[model samples]
Every structure is written in C-alpha cells, then in structure tokens.
Target: MQSFLSKIKDFNNKHRKIAPFIIWIEIILIFLASIMKNICRHYKILLAVVVVLIVIGISARHLASVESKTPEEGSVVAASEEMSVVEEALQEATVEASNEASGEESLINVDSAVSETSMENVDSAVSETSLENADAAASLESTASLYVDSGISEFIKAHTEAVGWIKFEDDLISYPIMQAEDNSKYAIEDADGNDSETGAIFLDYRSSADFSDSNTIIYGHNMRDRSMFGALKNYKEDLGFLDDHKYFQIITPEGSGRYMLFAFMDVPKNSYIYDVCGDNTSRMREFLDTIEYKTYIDTGIEPTVDDKIITLSTCTQKDDLFFVMFAVKVDD
Candidate 1:
C-alpha cells in the first residue's frame, strides 16, 4: 500500500499542470460510484443515462477546442512559409527606406551643384539632370510600404472577413481575428465560416477594421477547453501572471501594435467599458478614470487619451457578467 501511494504521488507531481483536471474527474467518478451503491436499483438505469450525457458533453467540448487550434482547412499558410514572407516584406521596407534616403541625398547634391554653377550655366546644369533622378525625388513622398502579414493576407483570400491577427507572446492566444457587418456573426461562426460554440476571436463591428480608432474592442468565447480568451481569466485569478505575460501583439496591415496589459476586471454586460471609439478627450479621460477605478489589479500603468486602447472581452460563467482585459499600445 505504501508503494502504491508513493506511485500516485509521483504521478501527480509529474503531471502537476493537469492535476486539477484529473482530480475533478476522480471526484465526479467517486461521487457517481457512491450514489450508484446507495440509490434504489430502480434508478440505476437513469443514473447510467446521465453519466453517458456528461461524457458526451465533455467529448464535444474537447473536440471543438482541438478543431480551432489551427487555421481553417488550409486557409492559412505554414509557419515557415509565413515567416519567410514577413522577412521578405521587412527587407523590402528597409531597402525602400534606404533608397529614399539616398534619393534625398542626391537631390541635395544636385541643388548644391546648381548653386555653385555660374548664372550663365544654371539652366544647363539643371537640364543635365536625368529624368529618373527627378522622378525619384518626386516619389520620395512615401518611404515605407504597408506590410500585411502573409498569414492575414492568406486568410483574407480564403475569407474576406479576416481583418488582422492577435497573439500573446509565450502563450496559446494566437489566432486570426475576424470582422463582419455586425459583431453577432463571428460570435457564433468560426474563421472558416462554420458555426461553432467556441467562435472565432473578432473585433467589434463598430470599431475600425484597421484598428485606427481611439479604442478597439475584441470579443472571444471564454471556452472551457482554454481556447479563445479562456486563459484571460488567469490575469484576474493571479495578478503575478501579468509580470511576464503582460504584453501581446496585434498584427494588422497598417502595422504590428505591441500592447502592454494595464488592467482587467469583471463588469456588467452593458458596462460603459463597451463605449469605445470615442474621440472626445474629456470623455476619454473619464473613461480612463473609470477603468482605474474598476480594474481588479493595479499594474501602475495608466493610459492617456492620446494612447490607443485595446480591450479583450469575454463572457463569464454568469449571463450578465463579462470579463475584460485592457491594454495600451506600448509600441507607439
């Protein structure tokens, strides 16, 4: 008996991450077993039916979570391929910036040369300049090209509703974000346009699709299988989780936004926190004050009206309860 107990302890220690799930399953089984032994024999069949239904529910939830782990059936390219494309886009931007800088230098040199030339030779010096150089100077208006993430581009090709991608560094919160005419569509539909209870992470319809608004709000299901925004609860459960995991990235065609978690809290479904995309500075200040007041933990970082805010919202266990995670664009 001592050796058997030691083995069980060792197993629990080795699988500490899933120990809670294992313990819950064990508790349910033990309770069911005890009831089976004590309940009248006439009710045994009914209990068996209930057990089967519970198992089916658990299985279905697990299956749905696993299915959303990857992008819809070939909708997204492989990681390596996506990385190469990003690298290429970055290289192109760098080269363009360098070339534009060079063009400006050339124009400066030409102007100086013309200035030094005698008045009689001024027209000839300007005329001698190549048409290509003139065009390059005019084209210097834009030094950088807009880079869209290859993954986002591919997903958009498959489904036009795909607007951007959201990822939490060193976490399981990476997914393509979807948008529709209304927020209700993606709430019940997957990125691939299939119906799913664990719907795709999506931006609020009222907010700008490019994330140009003063405040952008995103929504995802607080799934039981830890998919979508399910893990966001950790911020409220353990404030220490924010020490290392406070930063997340919002990748868009305009640019990639690096945001730092500032606050998280549970609020009513119709909380003023949902009043996003406002341009009023005084109202924004009031919004910031309200956020500071309602947040569960103090991260010591306060966002100003000038800084763009992003909110990740999910439903809690209660119908009227909602959990929200707020972040500021630290990269800007």
Candidate 2:
C-alpha cells in the first residue's frame, strides 16, 4: 500500500495538468454511480410521479390549444347576423302590409293619380323585400356549403385518417373522427398521429368508413380533463340531459346529417354491441333490445332491423365497464 501510494503521488507530480483532469473524471464517475444507486432504489414511485406530471402537462397544453382555436364568439356573431337578416325581412314585410292597409283605406277618397302612386310604392316595397329575402337565403346557403366543403377539406388535409366530424348538440362532444388500419393506432395517438392521452375519436377498424354499415361504432378516450368523450358520461347522470341533447350531427365529405339518440348504457368491455360487421337482423334486434334494457333514459325512438344505427363507446372508471351511446340516422 505504501509503494502504490508513492507511485500515485509520483505520477500526479509528473503529469500535473492531465492528472487533475483524470482526478475530475474519477470524481464525476463516483458521483454518477452514487446517483444511479439512489435512483434505482426509488425508481418505481419516481416513475409514477413523472408519468402523472407528464400526463397532466400534456392534457393542459392540449386543452389550451383547443380553446385558443375554437371560435365561440365568432360562431355566436354569425348566428346573430343570420337571425338579424331574417328579422329585418319580417319587419319590412309587416311595415309594407301596414302601408297597404292604409292605402286601401284611403282609396275610397283619394284621387286616381294618388292611388296610382301608392300602388306603385306598394309594388316597389314588395319587390325590394322579395329581393332582400332571396339574397339572405342565398347567403345562408352559400355559408352552409362553404362550411361543408372547406371545413371538411381542411380537416382532411390535416389528418388523412380523419373521415368526418361528429358533434353532439349543446355538448363538448364535437370532434373529428378518424380511422386507421387498426383500432390500436389511435388509442394512444391523436388524429395527427401525435402521442396523446386524449386520443382521437376513431371509427372501429371493422366498420365501414362511409358509415354505410348497419351499425357503426366509434371510440374515444374518457380523459379526466373533460376532453375527448369525457362529457358523454353526463348522459348517465341526468335523463333530462339525454332529452335536451337528443341529437347530434355527423358531417362527412359527401354531406351533413344527423343522428337521434335512442339509448345510452354501460356494458361489459366485450359486449356484443362492438360487433360492427354483424348482419343478422334478428340477432341485431336482440342486441338492440339488450342495449335499450340497459339504457339510462328512454328516448321513445325504437330502431327497426332495417334502420341504420351508430354507437359511440368509451371506457368507464371500472376496468371492465364501458359506456355507450346508441343513435339512429335521421333523414335530413
């Protein structure tokens, strides 16, 4: 030991500059080894906390992004503008009717020239009102068409898997629905294929992409942040909620249509309702009966075997339970 210590001191004295660097390297290695030992001892709990923080942070950031992009006030303004146009047309019609009534009352005593002038005024008002109403209708039609084409096209451009948009009336269930090669693709990924705990609303891998199937099934995560399909659980809380929000819209590239809520229930994760390709009418009816039996609310709208239906499903708090909403497509 004395001989080894003497050699080490002799080497340090000889290579002073390089020796200090070697000493620092040894010290760093020892410090890093100590840290590694501590980390290994408490890794499980630390990992859980880190995962939780990451999820919360990601959820917070995603929600903020969604809020920033949503044009709540803009939609209100546009709706108000549409209402104002209609109201103005109605008010003008009322005024013109009053003028006509006054003109008719005076016709018994007025001269021919005055009568002719009043008739001309009334005709002009009618024509002007007609033109305004026509213009307003055209404007509304154009806006709707633009929304159908441009909005869907833009969404498709963002994510090729995005087949359409689904929205529940008076709820936060509005989201773009995507379809991938497999259902698992979007389970942990968003529509853009980005990692997200709040996965994209997705059509069942076995379902028809055009929603032409007898029963189409869609899935989403029940994120704690009230995003994705989290608000769907609200239906189970209040039967009146189902009544108030009895319908939802599913907009596709081909056209826009609506679905009326018929039933919502919770079932085992492997319930037969997930079978999108089943075509047996009697079996389908039996399945529908089971769903209605388990429903939280009675929508009074029973679906026949020939009727097309859609089911929106998500996981519940129970590991084995899943919540589902069933609706039938209504003619627009």
Candidate 3:
C-alpha cells in the first residue's frame, strides 16, 4: 500500500505541469471514446454526459497565473506567466474535448448515414422469410403438378406428419397444419362433411402413388365469404400479391420441386374436368391451350404434358363456376 501511494505521488508530480482542464478533458475523452464503441445501446446517456462536461468546462475556468511570484517583482513578469497558463489550458482542453469523437458517425445513430442500411436489413429479413414461405409454397405447388408415384407416399408420410384434408364433392387437397408447412396428418372436412364444414370423419389418405395415376385432382369450396379458396381469388388479377405469392413448392421424400403459376380462371365443373383417358393427349393439349389463354397474368412458363400439372379447383358460382389455378413443375 505504501509503495502504491508513493507511485501515485510521483506520477502526480510528473504530471503537475499538465493543466487541470487538460487532465480532466483527457479522462472524460477516454470514457466518451469507450462509450462511443458500444453506443448502440447507450448513445443518448454518453452524448448527454459529453455535452454537459463541455458546458461545465467552458464556464468553470478561472483566468489565473501559472505561478504567483512576489508582488515586489516586476508586475509584468506575473502577467506574462498568467497569459501563458491561460493559453496552455485552452489548447489542452480542446484536444481532450474531441478525443475519439472522430471516425464513422455510426450507421444507426445518424439517419442520413444508416437509413438505407436499416431498410436493407428489413428488406433482407422480409426477403428471407418470404423465401422460406415461397419454398414451402413452391413445394406445395409442385405436388399439385406431379402425377403421384408410389415412392412419393413414403416421402409424404415421413415429412408431412401434419396433414389437413378437405373434400369438395370428389376432390381433396391435403396440406400441413401450421401456417407454413408440416408433415403431420390433420383433419379438414367440407361444409357438408360429417360435421357440416367440420370433420367427424377425418381420414388420412395415403399418397396415391400406390394406386392413383401421376395425375390426381382435388377440389375445395371457394366460398364467397373467403374460407377455403377465397384467398386464391386475388390471383385472378394483377397486384403486388404476385410479389408475395409466386411459385409453389411441393415436397415429398420422393422429390421436391419448384412450380410456376400458369393458369387462373373460372371453368365449368362438368366440362369433363377429370377425363385422362385414351383421349388424354389431345385433352391435355386442349386443356393447356385453354389455361394459357385464361391466365389472369402470364407467368412466362409454357406447359407440356411432359410437365405434370396441378390444378387447384374451387367454386365460383358463376356460369362455369370452377375457380382454378394451374401450376407446372420446374426443379426437383
């Protein structure tokens, strides 16, 4: 303890020539510099302290001689020393006041410097989230495009444990439970099902890969009140909606694919919508043409029988009344 105190004494004597204002300025400047580094969470408090210190320093200084000599000596000698001390103090204070206050003004602290960066971050987060959703949607749309294969059943069962099913007449579309996607099998019945829009007979239908052909169809209600397929109606027009809802992905253990939106329109239900018989080739060709001509907005993708198509059918209540959207598979 004695040694430490002696060291401090010696240090103080060595620094005695330093002006008091200068010493305080250096210490505060060092503190401010540290706060500046982590200012993201404490900028306001540090900035306030720095401002207060500056104001106090400015008002508290007393003009006095560096050393007082005998009054008997020439008075000019005392005046000169005082003038020198004042100049030295002022110069030292200025240096300590601005220590570490330089460099980049910080991107978040200044709107002019960092607004674009923040916007970019928001855009990136939204874009990433959108990408995740798009990937899920793309997977869904891809499934719609496929002709279900046997291997796909295992894939579906393994990945999509959470499944929701709906029956509108003879059609059903199964999906995961949560807002995004899941692999579990859940229940979704039609308004006319066991519970009249609820499900007393929620059944888990295995993938048609075992018995159904590559092409399968599912239909649901497009209630005017916007329950099942109501959200799909917006695709019938051009809007930023496409920006949010483009492409679909249908994933199964067998395969996963990216799908592009190709058709949007109302069609007659009894138009023999599900006839994939001997006339399938010509029928498919005709179907493709009709959908191409009917798309609300062209997504720039052409359809071929080589490409499996997934048709999302819903009720429209119009003359033809089948609200349908077609999507074709792209990547697996």
Candidate 4:
C-alpha cells in the first residue's frame, strides 16, 4: 500500500502540467452538472454525481490498461531526477501551447475589431438607394472588351482585335480574370502577372454592386507567411500594410490599368451598399459620395470619374464574414 501511494505520487509529480488540467476538467464537468440539476428540480444532482464518477472510473481503467509502465531498477534519487526531467519537458510543452493559443486569440480579436469598424463606416456612408441599387446593377451582365484604350495603356494580343490579356513587368498576364464563383475550380490568380500562384478569387456579386461600375472584387486567404493576401490583413492595424501594397495593376487581356486605393471599409455579409443607379452620372456621384464618406485613410493616388475600379475583399479571423478595400483604375 505504501509503495502504491508512492507510485501514484510519482506519476502526479511527473506529469504535473497534465494533472492540473485533467483535474480542472473534472471539476468543471462536476460543477456544470451540479448547476444544471439545481436549476431543474426534476434532475437530481445525486444522479449527475454518479454519472461523473462512472466516467472517471472508465477513464482511469482505460489509462491503466493502455499505458505501459516499465519499472526501472535504479537508485531512488536517480529515478526522481529522471521524473523531474520528464515533468520539465511536459511543462515547457504546455507553456508553448498556451502561448500559441493566446496569439491566435489576439489575432481573432484584431479581426473582430476591424470587421466592426468596417461595418460602421459602410453604414455611415451608404445611401438607402445605394442598398436598393445593388440588385439593379446585378441585372446587367457587363459585356467584355468594350473599353477602348485611349492610348493611356493597353495590352493587345499579337495581330488580334480582341484583348483579354496583358504583359506586365515583363510577365505576360491575361484576364477575363478566370474565377469560379462557387464550384470545383476554386482558384484565382493574376492573369496579368501570370502568377496563378496568387491564389486569389476575384468576385463580382453585384447583388451588392449598385452601379454600371465594374466591381472587381478580389479575395485571398490571409496566410501566416504573407503568402496570397496574407500581407493585406496587415492593413487592419498599420501603415506597413498600406505602404507596401496600395496600388493594384489590373492587366486585362485588352488593357492593363492601375487602380488607386480609394476606400478601406469592411461591409457586413448582406450589406447591399455595392449598388449604384443605372444613370451613369448618378452612379459616379454615388461612388464619389460613398468613397468620400468611407475613406478612413487614403492610398495616396486620387481616383477620378474616368478610372474603372477594383475591390479587394477578404475574411478575418475576428469576424464571422469579410472586409473589403476599394481602389480605382489608374493609367500608370
């Protein structure tokens, strides 16, 4: 009996980090059962206690049966020292796991804050008509290659009238920006940059876009390595994100145009603020108004009425949905 007690004590001392967590879990289970039974008179706390005890018994039996314990014949002091090393390793692992969890939680919190701020800005900026017009904008399917490059910038295929791709930074880029809205081909890349590696989905769901304006909504995963649009999420907290990536060079097959960042706001999932009127003037005016209202910080390049626009959208760990940053086409 004394030997058994010493063995149990040694096990506890060896796995101190795991021991406390298991004990706390047991306590929590027991406490929750107790509270539920007390709140419901028909549910007996005694029965809950019995159930918990049965669970504990089964767990102990399983552990005893599954774990192999080879008794080491060594000096008692040496055994104790080995046990201490094991305990230290377990504790260090536990601490590292805890720190990782804390960091994830912080990222989630930051995402939530950014989402909330985005919605607030959108709500403050959008007109009631803007919300309603999003549906109307969806009614029209934009015809391709109508844009005649006014000699500002153009990427035409060799000896062909139709232009759907371009060469940028010495890389041949193409467009019609191949995207699979919601199906098997779930991948996107800059046809212009020829980097299918971008792994971004450029979306155009004008059930939110209210205007004749092309809503080139793009999306990318926020990878930890800053791969895809991982670096874009950095815009949530600082200028390091903003300064490094502000302008987007959109190289469609017919033309390559740049867009300057005009607005950075996170709209809610169902926010119909993307709609603009059929009347071109009204549509442009609406864009001007919303951009002016939601422009938290600028990307420095001023967007005028003539430039087409691009919208980059992504989900954050903090929110259950997404946030978007808006920019307009530029000639350079």
lDDT of candidates 1 onward, in order: 0.68, 0.69, 0.45, 0.46
Models, CA RMSD each: 30.8, 27.0, 28.1, 23.1
Model 4, stretches more than 4 Å misplaced? 1-176, 181-199, 205-214, 276-284, 298-306
Which regions of candidate 2 are displaced past 4 Å? 1-149, 276-282
TM-score for each predicted model, relative to the true structure: 0.54, 0.54, 0.38, 0.40
User: Could you tally the backbone clashes for each prediction?
Assistant: 0, 0, 26, 19
RMSD of 3: 28.1
Residue-level lDDT of model 4, residues 250-326, one tens digit each, is 55433456655656776665554444322233465566667667666755555666656665655543344456777
Best candidate, lDDT-wise? 2
Q: For candidate 1, write residues 1-332 as lDDT tens digits.
A: 99999999998789999978989999999999888776766587788999999999999999999888967655555665557535534533443454355542111123333122111221111111223432332232121012132445655666688888887876447777888888778766667776554567888888888787778899887753455676786776667988989888888656688999899888888787687553433567887888999888888898888889898988764457888888998884
TM-score of 3: 0.38
Error of 1 at 81 (Å): 47
Q: How should the candidates be ordered by lDDT, best one leading? A: 2, 1, 4, 3
Predicted candidate 2 versus true structure: per-residue lDDT over 1-332, tens digit per residue = 99999999998788987977888999999999999999999999899999999999999999999989877898979987768646544544454465476544112212332222122221111112223333432343344345454677677776788888887766456677889888787776666576544556889888877888888888877643346676775676666777678888888887777899888888888777776453434568787788778887776778887888888888764557788889899965
For residue 170, model 4's alpha carbon misses the true position, in angstroms, by 14
**Over 4 Å off, model 3:** 1-194, 198-215, 237-240, 277-282
